[model samples]
Target: MAALADAEHRLGRGLPDDLRQLLLECDGIIGHTAVDTVWSVEQIVAQNLLFRTDSSFAQLYMSFDALLFFGDNGGGDQFAFVQTPQRPDIFVWEHETDSRRWVAGDLRDYLGRSLAEGGDAWYQ
Candidate 1:
């Protein structure tokens, strides 16, 4: 709870309720081949900050100010929550094409799909 609160403080916004509950229960979720399907509270804060402020990213891709990144596919693509409109839906930020698209309905749905048989590229 302290970590979550700290994360929220650092990010300047509250995370989704479902995500907060999950993080409180466990530091993070690990999936196939030991990948961090859902990142820990610390990583969540770090990664989001990096994406949002990295100078190179600013030139390479669209502004990340509207997204709250939380996980990665072990490939380069990442998962995030839409912060612009503050929805429960999760979206994938494909690094290659700079495309952002809906993937799961919420954190629960994201876990089911990402941890299933298809390995890390489940969203693909």
Candidate 2:
């Protein structure tokens, strides 16, 4: 709980309830091919901060202000929760195309699919 509190403070926003509950159970989830399907609290804070503030990212991709990144695909793609409207749905941010698309209904559904028999790009 302390970690989550610190993360929320650093990000200046509350995390999704489902993600907070999951992190309380486990720091992170290692999914197919040993990927960090769900990132630890520290990583979540750091990554989101980077994506939101990095000047290089601003030039390279679309604004990340609406996305709270939580994990990666072991490649370049990343998974995140939409923050602008604050929804439970998970979306995949394709690094190459800079496209964001819906992948799961919630954290539980995301874990079920990402950890199942489908390598790192399970959502694709």
Candidate 3:
């Protein structure tokens, strides 16, 4: 837990609200019984499980003001993005990483791309 928090602080990014809430529960900040889903991100990161999805195009949400997705970008190695969920659809470039396969898409790359000049589209 400390490792995860430190990594998040040093990198300055977080999982989607829903995922974070689940983590908080695991951290004893909330009741574990509150969780309804069977898959936990913690387990994924710990290599206890794999992504349970129907397709390779996985949908990931972040607490940060950016939209990120990681998977094969049509071909080659799995690609990563820090994209704007809005018109113009500005996106950030990033590389793939083991941690990103669960939490972030190479935080360094996404952090740079997600910090462009624009208000969050989520509120718009």
- lDDT score, residue 93, model 2? 98
Model 1 residue 121 distance off true place after TM-score fit, in angstroms: 1.0
TM-score (C-alpha) between model 1 and the true structure: 0.97
Q: Which regions of candidate 3 deviate over 4 angstroms?
A: 1-3, 6-13, 27-38, 46-124
Worst 10 residues of 3 by lDDT: 28-37
Give the Å shift of residue 123 in candidate 1: 0.8
Q: Which ten-residue region of model 1 has the weakest summed lDDT?
A: 115-124
- RMSD to native, candidate 2: 0.7
Candidate 2 backbone collisions, by pair = none
Root-mean-square deviation of every model: 0.8, 0.7, 13.9
Model 3 lDDT at residue 59: 47
Give candidate 1 misplaced runs (Cα > 4 Å): none
- Candidate 1 residue-wise lDDT at 21: 93
Clashing residue pairs in all predictions, respectively, total: 0, 0, 1
- As for candidate 3, its clashing pairs are 100-104
User: Local distance difference test, per candidate?
Assistant: 0.92, 0.93, 0.32
Tell me the tens digit of each residue's lDDT in model 1 across 5-100.
899999999998999999989998989988889999999999998888889989999999899988898888999999899999999999999999
